[model samples]
Target: MKKSFTLAEVLITLGIIGVVAAMTLPSLIGNYKKIETVTMLKKAYSEISQALKMAEVDNEFMEEWNFTAFENPDERVHHFFDYYLKPYIGTLKVCEPLEVGCMSDKIQHLDGINERPHAAGKMSFITKSGYSVLFWIHGDGTGGHFIIDTNGPHRQPNTYGKDIFRFILTFKNSSNVYADTAGYSKGLKAFGAVDGVTREELTGGNVSHAGLKPNYGCKSGLMGLYCAALIIYDNWEMRNDYPR
Candidate 1:
C-alpha cells in the first residue's frame, strides 16, 4: 500500500525548516534595513540636488557660503524659504519639532511656526565646505532606518559643517563659504562622502565627510542595489571613490 508519511516525520521536517528560517531570517532582515536606508539617502540627495539646481536659476547663487553667525537669521531664513526654496520645494517649511522624526506642521508659511528646540526656527544649509547650498528636506526618521540629518541635511550629501543648513552651495545672503561645518548642526548628518569624489588624498581633509555608512554602523556587509544607489547618489563623494 502507498504508505503516508507519519505525523512525527512531518513535524520533524517542519521543525528543521523552522530552524533554517530562524537562522536566515535575521540576516535577511538586516539586509533589508540596510537597503532601505541607502535607498532613502539616494532619493533624498537626488531631490535636494534637483531643487537646488532649479532654485539657482531664479536666485543668484551666493558668492560666499557661511552659516557661522547670521546678521539677520530670521530674514535670511525667510528669504531662503520664500524666495530661494519655495519655488523649487513645494510645501516646504522650517521643520517644527525638528528633533521629531515627522514633519508635524503642514502650513506652507514659515511665520509663527514653532522652531526646533535648539535651532529656534533658524535655518541652516547642507553642502561642501566651499560650495554653498541649503538642502534641508523635512521628514521623520523611520525607526532609525531613515534619518535625513545623518544622510545629507534634508537628504542630499553635499559637504560637512556644524550648521546643518549651510550646505555645500551657499545661499545668496549667507557669508563666506564656511568650511567643515557638516557635523555641527543638530539634525542628521550625511551617511556618505561628499561631492561624489572620494580620493585617498582628500580622505582626511577639512572637506571630507567620510565614514558615513548606512545601518548606523550596526553591521557591515553587502548592501542591496537600491541601498547602494541611495548612498552613491546622496553621498556623492563616497560613491565617487568606491570601486564598484
Candidate 2:
C-alpha cells in the first residue's frame, strides 16, 4: 500500500497553515493600502503642480491674478477654478457649492470622533483621473485652500491625512508673508509648508505652529493639515510611523 499521510496529520497541517495566514493577512493588506495611497497622492500632487505652472504661463503669476473682480464668494471661487485651474487640470465634472456628489458629505478627523462637512460656497470638482478637488478662496482673494481627495469622494477612510490632503495658496504679498517663515517661495505649498523642515519637525508633537490654531501638522488627534508635507518630507514615501 502506498504510504499516505494520516487524515489527522493532514488536518493538523492545514490548521497550522490557516493560523499563519490569518496572522499575516492583515499586515499584507495594510501595506498594500499604504502603497496605493502613496501612488495616488504623488500623482495628484504632480498633476496639480504641473497644472499651476502651465496656468501661470497664460494667466500670469497667481499673485497678479485678480479674483477681486468678483464680489460673491461663490463667484470668486468659480471664476478662479474655471479660469485658472479647470482648463489645465481637465476636470471631468464640476459640482456646485455645497454639492454632495463631488466630495464626501462628511470628512472625519484622524481620531475618528469629530466630523465636518465641506465648506459652503466653495466650488468642488472631480478630475478625470478620479481625484476630487475642492477650492476655498479667501475673501481678499490673496490666496486660499485646495483640498485634494486622492481616491475621490466615494472612497472610504474619508479622513484627513489618509486619503484627503490640504494645500495652501499664498499669493506673494508684503501683507501675506507665509513664504518667508514657511521656507517656501510663495504660490502653492503643502499646508504645513515643508520646504526646509524634516519629517520629525514637520510632524512634531505640537498642537500649534506659527500661530496657526489646531496646527494642521501630521500629529495624532489633530486636523492633519500638514500630513502631506510630512509625506513630501519623507520623499513621497509613507514612513513606518505614519499615522494611518
Candidate 3:
C-alpha cells in the first residue's frame, strides 16, 4: 500500500525547512541589498558623468564656467547648477542650499560616530531619476563637490560609503605632481582620487597611503569617502571585504 508520510514526519520536515530558511534568509537579503547598492551607485556615476560631458558641450569646459563670477556662494552654486548641470541632469525638484526636505539634515559618517551637517550655501535637489544630489563649491570657488544618495535620501543606511557617495568637479588643472605622474586628469573624479588617492589605496591595498586621510577610506571605521572609487576600481562590484 502507498501511504503518505505521517503528521509527525511531515512536521519534522517542515521544521527543518523553517530552520534552514531562518539561517539563510538574512544572508540572502544582505547580498541582495549589496547588489542593489552597487547597481544604483554605478547608475548614478554614469548619469552624472554623461551629464557633465553634455554640459561641457554646451557651456564649455567646467574650468571655464566662472564659479567665482557671483560673489555669493549661493548665487554661485545656483549659477553653476542652472547654467551647467540642470539642463543636462534634469532635476525633478530643486531645494535651496542646505534646505530641509531634499536632503537629510545630518549625514552620518561610515564610522557612525561623526556626523556631517549640511552646511549652509550648499544647493541640493532630487534628480529626475530619483537620486538626491547635493552640491558644494570649494572654499576658493575653484571647483565643487557633488554628493549623491544612490537610493535617495528617504531610504535607510543614509550613512556614507553605503547609499551615499561623493565626487569632485575639478575646474582647475591638477597641481599634484603625483597625480600628473600618475596620468590622472582634472575634471570629475571620485572623492579620494581627486585628492590623489590611487586606485590601489582606495581598494584597500595600502590604507596607510599618505593621500588617504584619517577617518576616510573604503574600509570600515573610516569616513568612507573613497568607497565609490573602490567600487569603480573593482569594476563596479563590491568586493568580498566591502564593509556592510
Candidate 4:
C-alpha cells in the first residue's frame, strides 16, 4: 500500500505556499508595471523624436511661420498641428486644446508639486498609437513643447514623470530639433541624484500621486518636468539600481 500524507500535512503545505505568494506577489506585479511603463515610454520617445525629424524635413522653418501672429492661443496651437504634425504624427482624434474629452488634467512638477492642483491641462491630441500629444507653440513661434502620455490619458499612473513626459522643441537657423529637456525640468528642486541615486527615484520604485518615494530622496515636486530624460540618460532602460 502506498503511504499518504495526512490531511493536516497537505493543508499545511498549501498554506505555506499561499503565504509565500502573498508576500511576493505584490513586488512581482509592481516590478512588472515598472517594466511595462519603461518599455512604452522608450517606444513613445523614439516614435516622437523620429516624427519630429520627419516633420522638420517637410515644413517651413518654424520662425518663418509667425505662430504668435494669431491672438487666439487655440488657433496658434491648431495651425502647428495642422501644418507640421498631423501629416505624419498618425493622429487618431484631434481635440480642442486642454479638453477633458481627450487629455487628462494631470500635469505635475515632480517634487510632489502639482502644476494644476485640479488637473487642468492645455491643448492636445490623441494619437493612433495610444498616446496623447500635448503640442504647444511659443507665442513667437520660434519654439514649442511636446508633452506626451505614454499610456494614453485615461490609464492609471497618469501622473507626470510616470506616464506623462515632456519634450522641448526649437527651431534655429532653419533647423528644428528636440532640445535636451529629457531629465528633470531645469531649475526645479531636486533631491535624488547625489552620487549613486537618480532616475530610479522618479521612475524605478512604486509611484504615488504624492510624488514621494519611500527610502529614496526623490520627491516628485519638481521631478516630473524632466524625468523623461532619465530614461534617455539611462540608455533607454531603467536599471535596477536607479534612485539608489
Candidate 5:
C-alpha cells in the first residue's frame, strides 16, 4: 500500500528543508549582490574609458594643455572638467560642488562596520549612467583622479571597493604596469599615481600607497585605493579568494 506520510513526518521533513535553506540562503544572496556590484563597476569603467578616448579626440594632444599653470586649483578643476570631461561624458546633473544629493554624505572603509564622515574638500556630480563621481584635477596637465560610486548614492553599503572605486586619468602608457614597474610618477602620469595595484610584484608588494594591504581597496583610510587594480589583476572578476 502506498500510504501517505504522517503529519509529523511531513512537518519534520519540511522543517529540515527550511533549516538547510536558512543555512545557505544569505550567503548565496550576498554573493549574488557582490556579482551585481562587480558588473556595475566594470560597466562604469568601460563607460569612463570610452568617454576618455572621445575626449582625447576632441581635445587634441593633452600633452600640450597646461592646467598646472593655473593658480587657483578650483579654476583648474573647472576648466579641466568643463573642457575635457563635461563635453564628452554624460552628466545629468552637476551638483554644486559638494551640494547635497551629489553624493553620499559619508564615505566609509571596507571593514564593513565602521561609519564616519569623509573629511575632505571635494566636489562631485551625478552621471546619467547612475554613478556619482568625485573629480579632481591636480592642476597639472597629466590628468587627474576619479572617485566613482558605481551604484550611485542611492544604494547601501556605500563603502569603498564596494559601491565606490577610484581610478586615475593617466597619460602614461599604463600597459605592462604589473609588478614593480609602477614608476607611475616617473613618467607623465595622472592623478596621485600612475599605476594601480598591478605593480604589487615589482615594488615588493607596494601599491600607489606605501605599505598597502592586499585586497584593501578604499579601506584603512583609503589605503586600499589600489584594490580595483587588484580586482582587475584577478581578471575583472571577484572571486572567493578576494578580500572581503
Candidate 6:
C-alpha cells in the first residue's frame, strides 16, 4: 500500500529532471569559462606589475624601464618566465623554462619553443595564428612591449580588419601605447621623446596596428588598455607601500 509509485511514474520524473539540466547546463558552463578567463588575466597582470614596481623602486629613475632588458627579446622571454612568472605561480613544470640555446638573437620570429603554457594548467601557448605573444623591451628605456605574431595578418582570426593589441610602455611614467602606421617605431618616439608629457598621458587612440576587438579585458573593455591601467594602478600602490 505505501509503495504506490509505479515504474512509469519514476521514469517520467527522472526525464523531467534531465530535460531541465540540459536546458541550463550550457549557460552555466559558459559563465564559468568567462570567470576563469578573467581571473587568469588579472593574476598575470598583477604578477607582471609587481615585478616592474620592485625593479623600478630599486632603480632611482622612472623614465621607462623594462624588467627584461639584458639581451634580445627571446632571451628576455626566458628570463621573464624563469625569474618573474615562476616565482608567482610556483609551478615550473607546467611552463618549462626556455633552453638557453633556444633563446635566439632574432627578434622577428618567435617559434623559439613548443607547447608553451598559456594559463597555469589550461591551454598551451599555441595561438590560432600559429604564433604566440613575445615579450620585449623596446631598444629605448621604455617599460616593455607585447609583440603579436607577424607571420599572419595582425588581427584576430577571421576578422581581417580588426587590429591586434601590441603595447609599449614608457618607463618615464609607465604609459601604455599601441603601434603606429610606421610600425612600432612611431609609438616608441611617442613614449620616450614626447617631452613634458608623462607616459601615462602620451597614449593615443588613433594607433592603427594596435587595435583589437572590444570587451577583451576582464575588468575593462579592452585587454591591452586593462593591462595598461592595471600596471599604472599597481605601480602607484607599490610606491605607497614602500614610500621611499
TM-score of each: 0.50, 0.88, 0.88, 0.71, 0.78, 0.44
Off by over 4 Å in 4: 60-68, 108-111, 117-121, 173-222, 241-244
Query: Per-residue lDDT for 80-191 in model 3, tens only?
Result: 7887778888677888976876777778777886566477668888887888888877646557778889888788778888888888777756554342112235677777
RMSD (Å) of each candidate, 1 decimal: 12.1, 2.7, 3.0, 7.4, 5.0, 12.5
lDDT of 2 by residue, 1-244 (tens): 9999999999999999999999999999988988888898888888888888898998888778777677788888888787778889878888998887888888876766655556665888899989898877877666788888999998888888899888877766323243322444467777776344555556655433343334455778767877888887788877888887
Worst 10 residues of 5 by lDDT: 186-195
| Candidate 4 lDDT, 34-63, residue by residue in tens | 787778777766676666567767875444
* TM-score for candidate 5: 0.78
lDDT for each residue of candidate 5 in 1-244, tens digit (9 for 90 to 100) = 8999999999999999999999999989979887887787777778777776677788866555567677776677777777777887788777655465767877766554554323233467788888888766664355566777888877876776677777766554434433222335422221234344344431125444543344444334444555566556667766674546
Off by over 4 Å in 5: 111-121, 173-182, 185-222
- Give the candidate order by descending TM-score: 3, 2, 5, 4, 1, 6
Local error of candidate 4 at residue 101 (angstroms)? 1.6
Find the candidate with the highest TM-score and give its number. 3
Best by lDDT: 2
- Model 1, 1-244: lDDT tens digits are 9999999999999999999999999978856644554454445556655765676666554332233343444544454456545567544234432333222111111112222322333343333311222223222111011123334333332112111111232233211223322322222223332334343312222333432323212112222112222344444323423322
lDDT of each: 0.35, 0.76, 0.75, 0.59, 0.62, 0.35
RMSD of 4: 7.4
Residue-level lDDT for 105 in candidate 5: 79
What is candidate 4's CA lDDT for residue 25? Answer: 100
By lDDT: ranked, best first: 2, 3, 5, 4, 1, 6
> Lowest summed-lDDT stretch of 10 residues in model 3?
176-185
In model 4, the Cα lDDT at residue 160 comes to 65
Residues 1-244, candidate 6, lDDT per residue (tens digit)? 5878899999999999999999999868855643443343344444445655554455544443354445555455555445443444322123223422111222221112222212221111223323333344443334455432222222223110011223353455332442311222222221112223233322222222233222322122223322233223344221212111
